[model samples]
Target: TEADPLADAVAAAVAEANEPQPSAPTGPPLPGGEKDAFRVAVGQCWNVGSLSTDALGTTVVVAVAMQETGVPDGGSIRMLSFSGGSEAAALQAFEAARRAIIRCGARGFPLPVEKFSQWRDIEMTFNPEGMQFR
Candidate 1:
């Protein structure tokens, strides 16, 4: 048994080398949340808004829009509008805008209409005509 100490060492090394490395965490889960690509797009859009604000506000806007409109462009427009409205009016406007955007061709996913109720948050009604929401 003592005839091959070097062989045992080599076997151990091979075993260690063959073991899989731990994968990097892919960040938090995102089933009912915004996708990563969409988040980056939203960040780029927010930077263009010239507003000094926090991520939470931006995140809320993006999430509500995505949940309501599905189209990236439409969601951004709605959020921008909702941001400036009074709280109560904004919520009402958000619901109205969501219905409008859906009617205008924004599609929902993962839950469909019956399952996912339209968002009625005050921060969801940014609709300026002639501006691009595509």
Candidate 2:
């Protein structure tokens, strides 16, 4: 089966956000430090039907949460929260939760990549099942 474009985009975005930084010098570790906190929780379940129309919606929700909480990197948050930590880990938890929800939604009902071009044309509905002329 072909990869879902929306899911691929979201995964790429999250991966980019979580990429390791090379410049931070080793020093006295930050107080209350922990291991990789960024991750998607598996046991927690969600109804994909409740998520927005596409992965973009999910990405937006995650980005907003990250902006609000100030942790753009997902791994740190995943490790701290799911691994057992504080409520301070809630925002990260939300991000992971939203992403998972969207991912599940995408898996259950994928959007077609061909629909992307429709955004440029008002007449285009981006409906894959719609009629095509010869």
Give each model's whole-structure lDDT: 0.39, 0.32
List, residue by residue over 1-134, the lDDT tens digit for candidate 2.
99999999999999988986544323344222111112212112332333333321321112211222222223322322222323434343455454653443333322223332211111101111121122
Pairs of residues clashing in candidate 1? 77-126, 78-126, 81-126, 82-125, 82-126
Per-residue error for 29 in candidate 2, Å, reads 48
TM-score of each: 0.25, 0.20
lDDT of each residue in 1-134, candidate 1, tens digit only: 35698898999999998886533223234444543343333322322132223311322232243444444245444544335445654455444444444444344333233322333222331333312244
The 10 consecutive residues of candidate 1 with the worst lDDT sum are: 47-56
Q: Which candidate number maximizes lDDT?
A: 1
